[model samples]
Target: MNGTISLFSAEASGPGLADLAGVLCGPGRMAGFGRTAARLSAVVDEPWRAHALARECRRRGAEAQVSAAECGRPLVRTPFRVDLLSLERRWCRGEGKVLPEGFRLDGGMLRLWALAAGSPQGNNYLLALDPEAPETYERLIAALAQLGVPAKVQRGEEALLRVTGRRRLLRVLELIGDAPLGAEAAWPSPVPVVRAV
Candidate 1:
């Protein structure tokens, strides 16, 4: 499954709440959980992303809320629930994001990350990495490579992973599936998919 980037096959079934890991991968954080409970908050660039992420969290059985942050960015977050404890423990390393020893990226997780901070620049797709947690960048890039989406870390004001080449971009589409409804960022490059009628 790690060799010969094929666009047809599915990656292995991910573990419980693996999609939530994507939030930590980007700008999301597993915090605010103590007296009231624990919450997972993700600040996104668009309103559609707020709704999309909330819906995904609900689909995963978490109660979610979407609202605009003080910075005016839309924020989607889950309520303090005991169910999220394991996730917080796994992703938080003393207040920083860190992948568990063996975490896998699935379509849902990839979609969440894309919704959070991914964008398309020309023919290449760029995924923003956490500037605070520079240590996890290599692991993330390696994980993407294992999933057949080879990417390189592009250092800048904010670090990013740029996925280049046509086949690799197509492979990204296959792995992450279709774009979210009402999505405007178009990280996967939402093209007019034609069908044979």
Candidate 2:
């Protein structure tokens, strides 16, 4: 399983994420996550939805920025964690199984599992693990529905990690720089194998 995490953005600079940071740390903590990137990655046919997500993040308590990408799948930056994407990747695949449909077994597009948080704006957080095979999409949807945060698997058309190694995620940020856009196009960062030793 691969690990990856994402935050919402608004105004192309991650207003949603900024808002989240403000609320969580009581001001000025937004920078803990880092600056926002210029562009970001999203499920292939859902740029607008992605935009909505960024706005939502601002509403939560953090700031976000987009990163650039040749494939068009964007990335973002934050100040709270070490290698946000890599951290997210570790969270997702660490305890989860490989999702058959939403994402590939190897690190490719991010496969997220959102849970209901009960917040007024809609409480949902991503699960660290990927989905397991034979775990029908319908079942996952039903589970999320029970939690009150309905979700669908988000996969992209582009294969960002076909032959790439997991360590490439770190290089992504280096390659892009602080343009706040595509500074790190690394999609799914390296994660410990779910069942492998």
Candidate 3:
């Protein structure tokens, strides 16, 4: 589901974003957070129970934050904003089962756009971290592709490349759907892409 979270943020917008945010940050929606581990044992597979997930996130270093939105979608509150409800859904049972946190890519470029090839919104996310380990990023992108996400991997600043000047890559990504990062899993990943020039 981590793949979905990554993909969702990458492709999120419109009503989908709102419905997800409402379930996450809404008052009384996270009531499950205050329960004992045993009480939540059954719903352990369901992370949308914002309260419980919030507690877990806090434990994992996700601080409490509020997002403002004109409509219903929750806005990003941090450099790495996420809708608890949407994230919860990704972590749920069935096809939605997301990889555990350890399976996710932590450092690299994480970008969120209003539309894949449209204007950027003020709410987009752009982050740069030391590149992830090759295997990790490979697993991450491969996981995304398996889940129907479009991804591209490049060398050095390539991963940092944006849609501003490049038309072909974006078109290809959109055309093929999502793809895995380029580079063999056996190699070391490149540096983190903090900005594109």
Residue-pair clashes per candidate, as listed? 2, 50, 9
Model 2: worst 10 consecutive residues (lDDT sum): 113-122
Best by lDDT: 1
Cα TM-score of candidate 2: 0.29
* Native-referenced Cα lDDT, model 3: 0.27
Rank the models by lDDT, top first.
1, 3, 2
TM-score for all models, in order of appearance: 0.83, 0.29, 0.25
Model 2 bad stretches (over 4 Å): 1-46, 74-90, 94-139, 145-197
What would the per-residue lDDT of candidate 3 be over residues 153-192, giving only the tens digit for each residue? 4456423212221332232233222322321111111222
- Return the number of clashes found in candidate 1: 2
Q: Model 3, residue 160: what's the lDDT?
A: 22
Error of 1 at 66 (Å): 1.2
TM-score order of candidates, top first: 1, 2, 3
User: How do the residues 1-197 of candidate 2 rate in per-residue lDDT, one tens digit apiece?
Assistant: 21332222122232322222111110011122233222122221234323433444444453445444456753333335443333233223333422223321110111111110101011212222222322434444443344233444444531111212334333221221222222112122344223223
Candidate 3 Cα deviation (angstroms), residue 97: 13
Candidate that would win on TM-score: 1
How far in Å is the alpha carbon of 1 misplaced in model 1? 19
Please tell me which model should have the higher TM-score, number 2 or number 3. Answer: 2
lDDT of 1 by residue, 95-178 (tens): 688888897776667867887888787667889888888998899998888878899999878899999877787778777666
